[model samples]
Target: MKQAIAQYNEAERLARQEKFREARPLLEAAAKSGYGRAWYALGNWSIHGIGCRKNYRQAFECLRKAVRYGAGREALFDLAICYETGKGTSKNVRQAARCYIESMQAGDPEAISEVARIHYWGIGVKPDHSKARRFYLRAARRGDLESAYLLAEMYLTGEGGTTNRRSAIDWLKRAVDSDDAKLAWDAKERLKQISAVTM
Candidate 1:
């Protein structure tokens, strides 16, 4: 195990230097030796053809192995995306949701937002605005810009409960600080609209 980790670390260093060809064999060796992160790295490389040919099937297999070996929360999220989009496996919304929930349990803020999205849109399960609001609030408090925006909209429209304009404005204010130009613009426009209405 220690040897595998060492090999994987060397591969990571090579990869950081853009030595993809030199890193590939090391990553493969580490993965074969039961290093979960190596499996995850190989999976990502396979999916995008970073150093290998694009092979969704191989990506799926590697990612599945990584997940079984407890790769990381990010790996779970990536697996969820693959399941949701049918990138390497069959489209299975239920499985995707399960993976997202698992990732969320692992404290991935993006996964938390995804769970909120699925609940809000009823992608694979029943639409539950209350649950969406709860998840969005959790993600928003963690500084997820998208979740903050969605939570603000929910508060403004009273989708899950009583309308709270103050809460909506607060969330929008938080969103205004986002680095994303579109989100910042949208938040600013909404804030202006709200202010006009109140005036």
Candidate 2:
């Protein structure tokens, strides 16, 4: 484990120095030794061609290996993105949704937000406005700005059910206080638009 850690550190240093060619072998060695972080880093570098050629296949392989080692929610999130975008595998919205759910279960805030997104947009699963709202609320509670905005939107529009102006305003204020200025602005606008409506 110490040797693996040393090699991983060396790989990270090499990557930082723009020596991707030198980093790959070390990263691979560390990753093969059960260093999930190294696998994740290698996946990122390979996917973006950061000092290395863009190879979705290679990136996918790295991420998958990390997943096998119980990497983290981020790896699950990335894999979900890849599946959704058909980077290394066929575009499979169902698979993507499952991945997002798994990531969320692993406590990934972004995955919670993504689950809300797909639920709202009816991307892979059937349109369930209540489910979408629930997901948004879950993510928002976890400090996800996007989910906070989405929850506010749902409240203001009453898309899933009757509108709740009070909840909308409250969540908007929370969003603002959370320092998500973009979401705060959107929530404010939505509040304004729904101010006249009554239950």
Candidate 3:
């Protein structure tokens, strides 16, 4: 057990230094010993072909094992993405939503944003603006700029309930300060339009 952990640790160290090739064998060793993180790492590597051939089947298997062994939030989130995009498995929107929900339950804030998206778009699940609003609010409060931007739109359009220009403006202002250039630009543009209309 200790040896497996050591292998996983060393693999992580090597991967951080961009030595994926060197880390692969160690990760494989740890994964074979039932290390969840190692399985997660191997899954990601298989998906992206970092140090091995890109094999969706292999990626799916590794990710499944990782999740079974209690992988971290990222692995769960990635698994959700896989289900959503058919990366290593058949595209299954319902399964994707389930994985996203699981990821959220696993404490992945990003999954909150994804859940909001699905609700807002009626993807695989019934469209529920109220649910989307709730998820967006949660993610935004957790400092997710994209969620804040989406929340601002919801406020502006009254997607879930009554329109609140003030709330929209506040969220836009917060988005404007984001480091993401595209989001900041959109926020600035929206703020301008809002000001023009109000003025």
Task: Give the per-residue lDDT digits (tens) of candidate 3, residues 1-199.
Answer: 7998999999889989999889989999999998898899899989999988999888988999999877957688888888889988899999888889889998987899999999999877999999999999999999998899999999999999889999999989999989999999999999999999989
lDDT over C-alpha atoms for residue 128 of model 3: 98
Ranking by TM-score: 1, 3, 2
Model 1 agreement with the true structure over 49-120: per-residue lDDT tens digits = 998799988998899889877796758888888999999999999998888999989877789899999999
lDDT of 1 at 155: 97
RMSD of each: 1.1, 2.8, 1.3
lDDT of each: 0.91, 0.83, 0.91
Q: Tell how far residue 190 is off in model 3, in angstroms.
A: 0.5
- Two-way TM-score contest, 1 vs 2, winner: 1
Model 3 scores worst on lDDT over the 10 consecutive residues at 68-77
Among residues 3 or more apart in sequence or in different chains, the pairs in candidate 2 whose N, CA or C atoms overlap within 3 Å are none
TM-score result, candidate 3: 0.95
CA deviation > 4 Å runs, candidate 1: none
Best candidate according to TM-score? 1
Report the C-alpha lDDT of model 2 over 93-148, residue by residue, as the tens digit.
Answer: 99888888899899877787788888888877888898899988888888876677
Best by lDDT: 1
